[model samples]
Target: MEAWLDGLPADSVGLRNRGLAYGDGLFETIAVHNGRAVLLERHLQRLAVGCQRLALGHDATLILTEVTRYAAAMGEGVLKLMLVRGDSQRGYAADPGRPAMRILQASPPAAYPVVHAEHGIKMFPCATRLAEQPMLAGLKHLNRLEQVLARAEWQDSTFAEGLMLDTAGRLVEGVFSNLFLVRDGRLLTPDLSRSGVAGVMRSELLAQAERAGIPVWIGDLRLDDLAQADEVFVCNSVYGVWPVQAFAALNWPAGPVTRKLQAIARSLLDA
Candidate 1:
């Protein structure tokens, strides 16, 4: 089966499902290599947190078992695990008694240009500002209208990503990934307490940096701060890491810290 809906062969959900109607759900994009899901634990951790925060009931063990079974069948690709509030009649209030819906899908991971990984890619500073919602901050919820709108701001092959800032004008993240910067031998990432998804790769990089004796900080960053950085990078679970060569007029080389973190990310995720 290419997809499973609550452990059954299915490719579509109902029209009234809360996930589709109101984006009452969460999802994780996992990389599968050699019949095993990479960073499965981290993905599940985030999912659990989302479920708790949303007051949605989910079986973590069941979801993990199904994900493993599904990924093994479609080895060496991307696996998306989606948890929805389940099918409900026309209403915003979810029924706590109803069981949650789980979706597992497998797709071929995109074959990115090797040069993009070797060197780096240019990005456009998106004009779409993210609205700060503390309740939804850091959770990879199904609601991605902001990112969709930001991504639509540009359609040029020259720009590989779009950098977005929160409504308060603090740097947030890339449209589809987490942002990081290096300056004076310290690693700094935008604080996502108000917006943006706290990506699994971001978490891994923070831990790895600590282990590698690199000082790391999570704080509010502005465009000027990013421009002053020696090196910058964007990361996702599937793409691993992409060094930011330039954003607007500012330019930066793929410095030592970025390269080191990139290597570490590959090793950790590919293991």
Candidate 2:
């Protein structure tokens, strides 16, 4: 894997970079297929929203241009873009006028077990819970210690992902993906207003569902909801969608809705 810092080949960032120092930044993991960035606009839109919410100064046009060029060069792979507040003095205070730093890394596409998407996966009941921070809820901020800890909870092939809940015990999302439930032909996903990431794939799925005449609901979700769901699945921009068959004592089959949405996700990622 190689990285580009500010559109130049680089292996390291400045010692005082705010992103390295305080995890002060946002990132996007994009998929590139046949020299094209998948969901490029949606990814950039989310990054723009994060920049606005964080008061980070960034040039959206420059980012788009560079990301496009990089993705073209990457062909079929994963492109990770990190935008940070640049270097600063050794303190919590940051210069508002400082230019942001852009770090881009390209790696080969992720490989997961075929059984995960075929027979479905068993989810680990993670004890790590997400903290409710409305200000930073939906943004893909650089601070990801919570997810780091949650992911570390499992280290076996038996579980494909971990189920994460918010501090208030509300069903939030997967360790690195968004959660969704299909109930009575309705699509239900957790609201990220107070916790979890508003994943690009999740947003896309909701829009696709609505356009396809599937009733979509976004709000608080509970374990009882998952238990009663007719189908369960988790999704990310990279891996698309994986049907979750088991979480703790509860189990579900990959039903018609899961298959339908999985196909939709497959088409999007493959496109």
Give the least accurate 10-residue stretch of model 2, judged by summed lDDT. 1-10
The 10-residue segment of model 1 with minimum total lDDT is 91-100
Candidate 2 residue-wise lDDT at 259:
90
Mind giving the per-residue lDDT tens digits that candidate 1 earns over 175-244?
Answer: 9999999999999999998999999999989999999999999999998998789999999999899999
The global Cα lDDT (0 to 1) of model 2 is: 0.93
Quantify all predictions' global Cα lDDT against the true fold.
0.92, 0.93
Query: What local lDDT does model 2 show for residue 260?
Result: 87
Residue 51 of model 1, lDDT score: 90
